[model samples]
Target: AQSVAQPEDQVNVAEGNPLTVKCTYSVSGNPYLFWYVQYPNRGLQFLLKYITGDNLVKGSYGFEAEFNKSQTSFHLKKPSALVSDSALYFCAVRDKNAGNYQLIWGAGTKLIIKP
Candidate 1:
Protein backbone atom coordinates (compact mmCIF):
# COMPACT_ATOMS: atom_id res chain seq x y z
CA ALA A 1 0.00 0.00 0.00
CA GLN A 2 1.07 3.63 -0.66
CA SER A 3 0.15 6.52 1.55
CA VAL A 4 1.25 10.00 2.69
CA ALA A 5 0.85 11.80 5.99
CA GLN A 6 1.12 15.52 6.65
CA PRO A 7 1.34 15.79 10.39
CA GLU A 8 0.63 19.50 10.60
CA ASP A 9 -2.83 20.88 10.08
CA GLN A 10 -1.45 24.34 9.49
CA VAL A 11 1.74 26.35 9.62
CA ASN A 12 1.87 29.98 10.73
CA VAL A 13 4.74 32.21 9.63
CA ALA A 14 5.63 35.86 9.38
CA GLU A 15 5.54 37.52 6.01
CA GLY A 16 9.28 37.25 5.49
CA ASN A 17 10.46 34.26 7.46
CA PRO A 18 11.28 30.73 6.47
CA LEU A 19 8.58 28.09 6.66
CA THR A 20 8.21 24.34 6.42
CA VAL A 21 5.36 21.83 6.10
CA LYS A 22 6.21 18.24 6.99
CA CYS A 23 5.37 15.18 4.97
CA THR A 24 6.07 11.44 5.09
CA TYR A 25 5.20 8.56 2.84
CA SER A 26 5.12 4.78 2.48
CA VAL A 27 5.28 2.96 -0.80
CA SER A 28 5.89 -0.50 -2.22
CA GLY A 29 8.45 0.51 -4.85
CA ASN A 30 10.44 3.51 -5.97
CA PRO A 31 8.15 6.51 -5.63
CA TYR A 32 7.59 9.58 -7.72
CA LEU A 33 7.42 12.38 -5.21
CA PHE A 34 5.69 15.70 -5.80
CA TRP A 35 4.68 18.91 -4.08
CA TYR A 36 1.71 21.02 -5.08
CA VAL A 37 0.05 24.22 -3.94
CA GLN A 38 -3.57 25.24 -4.14
CA TYR A 39 -5.23 28.59 -3.87
CA PRO A 40 -8.84 28.89 -2.73
CA ASN A 41 -11.28 27.51 -5.31
CA ARG A 42 -8.45 26.56 -7.61
CA GLY A 43 -6.87 23.27 -8.61
CA LEU A 44 -3.44 22.25 -7.39
CA GLN A 45 -0.42 23.63 -9.17
CA PHE A 46 2.72 21.53 -9.53
CA LEU A 47 5.54 22.88 -7.44
CA LEU A 48 8.20 20.24 -7.88
CA LYS A 49 8.95 16.55 -8.36
CA TYR A 50 11.67 14.09 -7.43
CA ILE A 51 11.93 11.14 -9.77
CA THR A 52 15.49 10.01 -9.10
CA GLY A 53 19.04 11.19 -8.45
CA ASP A 54 19.10 14.40 -6.48
CA ASN A 55 18.03 14.40 -2.87
CA LEU A 56 17.45 18.17 -2.90
CA VAL A 57 15.03 19.33 -5.55
CA LYS A 58 14.06 22.96 -6.22
CA GLY A 59 10.84 24.20 -7.67
CA SER A 60 8.55 27.14 -8.39
CA TYR A 61 7.85 30.05 -6.04
CA GLY A 62 11.35 29.70 -4.57
CA PHE A 63 10.41 26.44 -2.83
CA GLU A 64 12.58 23.41 -2.35
CA ALA A 65 12.32 19.97 -0.79
CA GLU A 66 14.76 17.49 0.66
CA PHE A 67 14.08 13.84 -0.04
CA ASN A 68 15.14 11.56 2.79
CA LYS A 69 14.89 7.98 1.66
CA SER A 70 15.96 6.38 4.93
CA GLN A 71 13.31 8.21 6.91
CA THR A 72 10.74 7.95 4.12
CA SER A 73 10.24 11.69 4.35
CA PHE A 74 10.14 14.66 2.05
CA HIS A 75 9.79 18.06 3.69
CA LEU A 76 9.09 21.32 1.87
CA LYS A 77 11.13 24.43 2.56
CA LYS A 78 11.73 28.01 1.53
CA PRO A 79 14.46 30.53 2.24
CA SER A 80 11.92 33.25 2.91
CA ALA A 81 8.18 33.20 3.18
CA LEU A 82 5.90 35.74 1.57
CA VAL A 83 2.40 36.95 2.35
CA SER A 84 1.42 35.88 -1.13
CA ASP A 85 2.96 32.49 -0.43
CA SER A 86 0.29 31.71 2.09
CA ALA A 87 -1.79 28.90 0.65
CA LEU A 88 -2.68 25.23 1.01
CA TYR A 89 -0.02 22.66 0.29
CA PHE A 90 -0.21 18.97 -0.52
CA CYS A 91 2.39 16.28 -0.85
CA ALA A 92 1.80 13.42 -3.21
CA VAL A 93 3.40 10.14 -4.29
CA ARG A 94 2.91 7.74 -7.13
CA ASP A 95 4.06 4.16 -7.44
CA LYS A 96 6.37 3.43 -10.32
CA ASN A 97 4.58 0.22 -11.17
CA ALA A 98 1.05 1.42 -10.61
CA GLY A 99 -0.75 1.32 -13.94
CA ASN A 100 -3.04 4.30 -13.48
CA TYR A 101 -0.41 6.88 -12.57
CA GLN A 102 -2.75 8.34 -10.01
CA LEU A 103 -1.18 10.33 -7.21
CA ILE A 104 -1.86 9.51 -3.58
CA TRP A 105 -2.31 12.90 -1.87
CA GLY A 106 -1.96 14.15 1.65
CA ALA A 107 -4.85 15.89 3.34
CA GLY A 108 -3.09 19.27 3.12
CA THR A 109 -1.46 21.87 5.34
CA LYS A 110 -2.70 25.43 5.40
CA LEU A 111 0.07 28.05 5.49
CA ILE A 112 -0.81 31.33 7.10
CA ILE A 113 1.38 34.38 6.81
CA LYS A 114 1.02 37.38 9.07
CA PRO A 115 1.64 40.88 7.81
Candidate 2:
Protein backbone atom coordinates (compact mmCIF):
# COMPACT_ATOMS: atom_id res chain seq x y z
CA ALA A 1 0.00 0.00 0.00
CA GLN A 2 1.04 3.62 -0.63
CA SER A 3 0.66 6.32 1.97
CA VAL A 4 1.61 9.94 2.59
CA ALA A 5 2.05 11.73 5.88
CA GLN A 6 2.11 15.40 6.87
CA PRO A 7 3.06 15.02 10.51
CA GLU A 8 2.29 18.58 11.55
CA ASP A 9 -1.23 19.83 11.72
CA GLN A 10 0.08 23.40 11.52
CA VAL A 11 3.31 25.21 10.77
CA ASN A 12 3.81 28.70 12.20
CA VAL A 13 6.32 31.24 10.96
CA ALA A 14 6.89 34.98 11.03
CA GLU A 15 6.78 37.20 7.99
CA GLY A 16 10.06 37.28 6.05
CA ASN A 17 11.21 34.13 7.76
CA PRO A 18 11.68 30.80 6.07
CA LEU A 19 8.79 28.37 6.18
CA THR A 20 8.66 24.62 5.73
CA VAL A 21 6.00 21.95 5.73
CA LYS A 22 7.10 18.37 6.17
CA CYS A 23 5.86 15.43 4.13
CA THR A 24 6.83 11.78 3.80
CA TYR A 25 5.58 8.85 1.78
CA SER A 26 5.81 5.10 1.38
CA VAL A 27 5.25 3.22 -1.85
CA SER A 28 6.62 0.44 -3.96
CA GLY A 29 8.68 0.99 -7.12
CA ASN A 30 9.14 4.66 -8.08
CA PRO A 31 6.97 7.26 -6.37
CA TYR A 32 5.34 10.33 -7.81
CA LEU A 33 5.09 13.05 -5.16
CA PHE A 34 3.21 16.31 -5.34
CA TRP A 35 2.37 19.38 -3.27
CA TYR A 36 -0.75 21.51 -3.46
CA VAL A 37 -2.22 24.51 -1.72
CA GLN A 38 -5.89 24.87 -0.85
CA TYR A 39 -7.89 28.06 -0.60
CA PRO A 40 -11.46 28.79 0.25
CA ASN A 41 -13.86 28.26 -2.71
CA ARG A 42 -10.89 27.52 -4.92
CA GLY A 43 -9.88 23.99 -5.79
CA LEU A 44 -6.49 22.51 -5.03
CA GLN A 45 -3.76 24.46 -6.76
CA PHE A 46 -0.82 22.50 -8.08
CA LEU A 47 2.45 23.54 -6.50
CA LEU A 48 5.15 21.20 -7.77
CA LYS A 49 5.80 17.57 -8.57
CA TYR A 50 8.68 15.12 -8.21
CA ILE A 51 8.49 12.53 -10.93
CA THR A 52 12.12 11.94 -11.80
CA GLY A 53 15.43 13.74 -11.89
CA ASP A 54 16.26 16.76 -9.70
CA ASN A 55 16.04 16.06 -6.01
CA LEU A 56 15.17 19.73 -5.53
CA VAL A 57 12.07 20.90 -7.37
CA LYS A 58 10.83 24.49 -7.39
CA GLY A 59 7.19 25.39 -7.54
CA SER A 60 4.96 28.46 -7.71
CA TYR A 61 4.90 31.28 -5.13
CA GLY A 62 8.63 30.97 -4.51
CA PHE A 63 8.18 27.55 -3.01
CA GLU A 64 10.42 24.54 -3.48
CA ALA A 65 10.70 21.01 -2.18
CA GLU A 66 13.50 18.58 -1.46
CA PHE A 67 12.91 15.03 -2.53
CA ASN A 68 14.90 12.48 -0.52
CA LYS A 69 14.32 9.04 -1.85
CA SER A 70 16.38 7.33 0.82
CA GLN A 71 14.36 8.97 3.54
CA THR A 72 11.11 8.80 1.62
CA SER A 73 10.48 12.49 2.24
CA PHE A 74 9.50 15.54 0.21
CA HIS A 75 9.48 18.64 2.40
CA LEU A 76 8.25 22.02 1.12
CA LYS A 77 10.36 25.12 1.70
CA LYS A 78 10.04 28.84 1.12
CA PRO A 79 12.86 31.23 1.87
CA SER A 80 10.69 34.23 2.75
CA ALA A 81 7.32 33.77 4.29
CA LEU A 82 4.44 36.10 3.58
CA VAL A 83 1.23 36.74 5.48
CA SER A 84 -0.71 36.03 2.32
CA ASP A 85 0.97 32.64 1.96
CA SER A 86 -0.96 31.26 4.88
CA ALA A 87 -3.10 28.38 3.71
CA LEU A 88 -3.67 24.65 3.97
CA TYR A 89 -1.04 22.59 2.20
CA PHE A 90 -1.33 19.01 1.09
CA CYS A 91 1.12 16.31 0.08
CA ALA A 92 0.09 13.62 -2.35
CA VAL A 93 1.41 10.53 -4.09
CA ARG A 94 0.20 8.71 -7.16
CA ASP A 95 -0.95 5.14 -6.74
CA LYS A 96 -1.80 2.90 -9.64
CA ASN A 97 -4.43 0.31 -8.90
CA ALA A 98 -6.13 -1.97 -11.36
CA GLY A 99 -4.90 0.01 -14.37
CA ASN A 100 -6.10 3.32 -12.97
CA TYR A 101 -3.94 5.93 -11.29
CA GLN A 102 -5.26 7.77 -8.24
CA LEU A 103 -3.84 10.32 -5.85
CA ILE A 104 -3.44 9.52 -2.19
CA TRP A 105 -3.42 12.76 -0.25
CA GLY A 106 -2.31 13.68 3.22
CA ALA A 107 -4.61 15.05 5.88
CA GLY A 108 -3.23 18.61 5.48
CA THR A 109 -1.05 21.17 7.21
CA LYS A 110 -2.22 24.71 7.90
CA LEU A 111 0.52 27.31 7.55
CA ILE A 112 0.33 30.48 9.63
CA ILE A 113 2.52 33.46 8.95
CA LYS A 114 2.44 36.46 11.28
CA PRO A 115 3.97 39.83 10.84
Candidate 3:
Protein backbone atom coordinates (compact mmCIF):
# COMPACT_ATOMS: atom_id res chain seq x y z
CA ALA A 1 0.00 0.00 0.00
CA GLN A 2 1.10 3.52 -0.79
CA SER A 3 0.12 6.66 1.04
CA VAL A 4 0.90 10.36 1.09
CA ALA A 5 1.09 12.74 4.00
CA GLN A 6 0.91 16.50 4.00
CA PRO A 7 1.79 17.65 7.49
CA GLU A 8 0.86 21.25 6.99
CA ASP A 9 -2.76 22.33 6.92
CA GLN A 10 -1.73 25.75 5.69
CA VAL A 11 1.44 27.53 4.59
CA ASN A 12 1.72 31.30 4.79
CA VAL A 13 4.32 33.16 2.75
CA ALA A 14 4.87 36.76 1.90
CA GLU A 15 4.71 37.84 -1.73
CA GLY A 16 8.06 37.58 -3.57
CA ASN A 17 9.41 35.17 -0.95
CA PRO A 18 10.24 31.59 -1.58
CA LEU A 19 7.59 29.08 -0.53
CA THR A 20 7.54 25.38 0.12
CA VAL A 21 4.82 22.85 0.89
CA LYS A 22 5.98 19.68 2.62
CA CYS A 23 5.07 16.14 1.52
CA THR A 24 6.02 12.62 2.45
CA TYR A 25 5.09 9.17 1.16
CA SER A 26 5.21 5.52 2.10
CA VAL A 27 5.22 2.69 -0.42
CA SER A 28 6.24 -0.93 -0.88
CA GLY A 29 8.51 -0.39 -3.82
CA ASN A 30 9.66 2.73 -5.57
CA PRO A 31 7.02 5.42 -5.28
CA TYR A 32 5.49 7.46 -8.04
CA LEU A 33 4.89 10.87 -6.58
CA PHE A 34 3.05 13.87 -7.93
CA TRP A 35 1.91 17.33 -6.92
CA TYR A 36 -1.24 19.17 -7.90
CA VAL A 37 -2.85 22.51 -7.23
CA GLN A 38 -6.52 23.40 -6.94
CA TYR A 39 -8.23 26.73 -6.96
CA PRO A 40 -11.63 27.55 -5.56
CA ASN A 41 -14.37 25.59 -7.38
CA ARG A 42 -11.76 24.06 -9.71
CA GLY A 43 -10.41 20.59 -10.22
CA LEU A 44 -6.87 19.55 -9.33
CA GLN A 45 -4.31 20.64 -11.89
CA PHE A 46 -1.20 18.61 -12.55
CA LEU A 47 1.94 20.29 -11.32
CA LEU A 48 4.87 17.87 -11.60
CA LYS A 49 5.82 14.22 -11.26
CA TYR A 50 8.67 12.08 -9.99
CA ILE A 51 8.73 8.73 -11.71
CA THR A 52 12.50 8.59 -12.10
CA GLY A 53 15.61 10.50 -13.08
CA ASP A 54 16.53 13.87 -11.61
CA ASN A 55 15.86 14.57 -7.97
CA LEU A 56 14.78 18.08 -8.85
CA VAL A 57 11.77 18.32 -11.17
CA LYS A 58 10.22 21.46 -12.56
CA GLY A 59 6.58 22.05 -13.41
CA SER A 60 3.94 24.57 -14.36
CA TYR A 61 3.71 28.05 -12.83
CA GLY A 62 7.39 28.19 -11.88
CA PHE A 63 7.11 25.35 -9.40
CA GLU A 64 9.69 22.66 -8.66
CA ALA A 65 10.11 19.75 -6.28
CA GLU A 66 12.98 17.78 -4.83
CA PHE A 67 12.55 14.01 -4.79
CA ASN A 68 14.31 12.78 -1.70
CA LYS A 69 14.29 9.02 -1.70
CA SER A 70 16.15 8.55 1.57
CA GLN A 71 13.76 10.79 3.46
CA THR A 72 10.69 9.70 1.47
CA SER A 73 9.94 13.31 0.82
CA PHE A 74 8.91 15.30 -2.27
CA HIS A 75 8.62 18.88 -1.18
CA LEU A 76 7.20 21.46 -3.58
CA LYS A 77 9.11 24.71 -3.99
CA LYS A 78 8.78 28.06 -5.70
CA PRO A 79 11.60 30.55 -6.16
CA SER A 80 9.25 33.39 -5.40
CA ALA A 81 5.74 33.40 -4.10
CA LEU A 82 2.88 35.32 -5.68
CA VAL A 83 -0.51 36.37 -4.43
CA SER A 84 -2.05 34.43 -7.29
CA ASP A 85 -0.16 31.32 -6.20
CA SER A 86 -2.34 30.97 -3.13
CA ALA A 87 -4.26 27.73 -3.53
CA LEU A 88 -4.74 24.25 -2.18
CA TYR A 89 -1.85 21.88 -2.82
CA PHE A 90 -2.01 18.13 -2.76
CA CYS A 91 0.54 15.37 -2.79
CA ALA A 92 -0.37 12.02 -4.32
CA VAL A 93 1.25 8.62 -4.62
CA ARG A 94 0.60 5.73 -7.01
CA ASP A 95 0.55 2.26 -5.50
CA LYS A 96 2.42 0.00 -7.85
CA ASN A 97 1.34 -3.04 -5.87
CA ALA A 98 -2.35 -2.19 -6.09
CA GLY A 99 -4.34 -3.99 -8.76
CA ASN A 100 -6.20 -0.88 -9.78
CA TYR A 101 -4.31 2.21 -10.83
CA GLN A 102 -5.41 4.86 -8.43
CA LEU A 103 -3.65 7.67 -6.64
CA ILE A 104 -3.69 7.84 -2.87
CA TRP A 105 -4.24 11.49 -2.25
CA GLY A 106 -2.96 13.55 0.67
CA ALA A 107 -5.01 15.94 2.74
CA GLY A 108 -4.56 19.21 0.93
CA THR A 109 -2.48 22.11 2.21
CA LYS A 110 -3.76 25.60 1.65
CA LEU A 111 -1.05 28.01 0.53
CA ILE A 112 -1.67 31.62 1.53
CA ILE A 113 0.54 34.30 0.06
CA LYS A 114 0.25 37.71 1.66
CA PRO A 115 1.26 40.83 -0.16
Candidate 4:
Protein backbone atom coordinates (compact mmCIF):
# COMPACT_ATOMS: atom_id res chain seq x y z
CA ALA A 1 0.00 0.00 0.00
CA GLN A 2 1.15 3.51 -0.81
CA SER A 3 1.12 5.89 2.12
CA VAL A 4 2.56 9.10 3.50
CA ALA A 5 3.39 10.05 7.07
CA GLN A 6 3.66 13.56 8.47
CA PRO A 7 5.09 13.10 11.92
CA GLU A 8 4.46 16.63 13.12
CA ASP A 9 0.99 17.68 14.12
CA GLN A 10 1.98 21.33 13.97
CA VAL A 11 4.97 23.53 13.23
CA ASN A 12 5.36 27.03 14.67
CA VAL A 13 7.60 29.53 12.93
CA ALA A 14 8.26 33.20 13.31
CA GLU A 15 7.47 35.41 10.38
CA GLY A 16 10.58 35.69 8.13
CA ASN A 17 12.57 32.71 9.38
CA PRO A 18 12.91 29.66 7.17
CA LEU A 19 10.58 26.75 7.82
CA THR A 20 10.25 23.10 7.01
CA VAL A 21 7.55 20.45 7.17
CA LYS A 22 8.69 16.85 7.00
CA CYS A 23 7.16 13.88 5.26
CA THR A 24 7.96 10.24 4.53
CA TYR A 25 6.39 7.67 2.25
CA SER A 26 6.12 4.01 1.31
CA VAL A 27 5.09 2.79 -2.11
CA SER A 28 5.51 -0.05 -4.57
CA GLY A 29 6.93 1.85 -7.54
CA ASN A 30 8.30 5.25 -8.43
CA PRO A 31 6.00 7.61 -6.59
CA TYR A 32 4.55 10.91 -7.65
CA LEU A 33 4.94 13.13 -4.61
CA PHE A 34 3.26 16.43 -3.96
CA TRP A 35 2.80 19.16 -1.37
CA TYR A 36 -0.41 21.12 -0.93
CA VAL A 37 -1.46 23.98 1.29
CA GLN A 38 -5.00 24.59 2.50
CA TYR A 39 -6.43 27.71 4.04
CA PRO A 40 -9.40 27.88 6.31
CA ASN A 41 -12.51 26.53 4.58
CA ARG A 42 -10.66 26.44 1.29
CA GLY A 43 -9.42 23.72 -1.07
CA LEU A 44 -5.81 22.71 -1.30
CA GLN A 45 -3.43 24.73 -3.41
CA PHE A 46 -0.52 22.96 -5.08
CA LEU A 47 2.85 23.73 -3.60
CA LEU A 48 5.27 21.46 -5.44
CA LYS A 49 5.83 17.98 -6.79
CA TYR A 50 8.54 15.39 -7.35
CA ILE A 51 7.88 13.35 -10.42
CA THR A 52 10.99 12.34 -12.37
CA GLY A 53 13.73 14.90 -12.10
CA ASP A 54 15.90 16.95 -9.79
CA ASN A 55 15.72 16.15 -6.12
CA LEU A 56 15.14 19.78 -5.24
CA VAL A 57 11.92 20.96 -6.81
CA LYS A 58 10.61 24.49 -6.33
CA GLY A 59 7.03 25.67 -6.40
CA SER A 60 4.57 28.41 -5.67
CA TYR A 61 4.87 30.98 -2.84
CA GLY A 62 8.63 30.54 -2.50
CA PHE A 63 8.37 26.92 -1.43
CA GLU A 64 10.48 23.93 -2.40
CA ALA A 65 11.04 20.26 -1.61
CA GLU A 66 13.75 17.65 -1.72
CA PHE A 67 13.02 14.10 -2.77
CA ASN A 68 15.19 11.56 -1.04
CA LYS A 69 14.78 8.24 -2.77
CA SER A 70 16.91 6.22 -0.37
CA GLN A 71 15.00 7.46 2.64
CA THR A 72 11.67 7.45 0.84
CA SER A 73 11.10 10.97 1.94
CA PHE A 74 9.94 14.27 0.46
CA HIS A 75 10.25 17.16 2.84
CA LEU A 76 8.90 20.62 2.05
CA LYS A 77 11.06 23.67 2.68
CA LYS A 78 11.02 27.43 2.38
CA PRO A 79 14.02 29.73 2.55
CA SER A 80 11.94 32.25 4.50
CA ALA A 81 8.61 32.02 6.25
CA LEU A 82 5.71 34.41 6.28
CA VAL A 83 2.74 34.99 8.55
CA SER A 84 0.51 34.61 5.52
CA ASP A 85 2.08 31.23 4.93
CA SER A 86 0.47 29.87 8.04
CA ALA A 87 -1.96 27.16 7.07
CA LEU A 88 -2.40 23.41 6.77
CA TYR A 89 -0.02 21.37 4.69
CA PHE A 90 -0.62 17.91 3.31
CA CYS A 91 1.78 15.50 1.67
CA ALA A 92 0.58 13.08 -0.93
CA VAL A 93 1.73 10.28 -3.20
CA ARG A 94 0.16 8.63 -6.23
CA ASP A 95 0.38 4.93 -7.00
CA LYS A 96 1.16 4.45 -10.64
CA ASN A 97 -0.85 1.26 -10.91
CA ALA A 98 -3.75 2.48 -8.80
CA GLY A 99 -5.67 3.64 -11.94
CA ASN A 100 -7.12 6.89 -10.66
CA TYR A 101 -3.92 8.71 -9.76
CA GLN A 102 -5.87 9.96 -6.79
CA LEU A 103 -3.32 10.85 -4.15
CA ILE A 104 -3.03 9.04 -0.87
CA TRP A 105 -2.79 11.91 1.62
CA GLY A 106 -1.06 12.49 4.91
CA ALA A 107 -2.86 13.69 8.04
CA GLY A 108 -1.60 17.25 7.45
CA THR A 109 0.62 19.53 9.50
CA LYS A 110 -0.71 22.79 10.78
CA LEU A 111 1.78 25.64 10.26
CA ILE A 112 1.60 28.66 12.53
CA ILE A 113 3.66 31.74 11.87
CA LYS A 114 3.96 34.43 14.48
CA PRO A 115 4.27 38.07 13.59
Best by TM-score: 3
- By lDDT, is 2 or 3 better? 3
TM-score for each prediction? 0.95, 0.94, 0.96, 0.95
Off by over 4 Å in 4: none
- Indicate whether candidate 3 or candidate 4 has the larger TM-score: 3
Reference-based lDDT, residue 106, model 2: 95
Q: Could you tell me the lDDT of residue 64 within candidate 2?
A: 100
Model 2, runs deviating above 4 Å: 96-99
How does candidate 4 fare on TM-score? 0.95
TM-score between candidate 1 and the true structure: 0.95
Backbone Cα, N, C clashes tallied per candidate = 0, 0, 0, 0
Per-residue lDDT, model 2, residue 45, is 98
Q: What's model 3's overall lDDT? A: 0.95
Candidate 4, residues 1-115, lDDT tens digits: the string is: 8789999999999988999999999988889999999999999999989999899999999999999999999999998899999999999999787777688999999999999
Q: What TM-score, to 2 decimals, does candidate 2 have? A: 0.94
Question: Candidate 4 overall Cα lDDT vs. reference?
Answer: 0.94
Go through the candidates in order and give the C-alpha RMSD of each one to the true structure.
1.0, 1.4, 0.9, 1.0
Whole-structure CA lDDT of model 1: 0.94
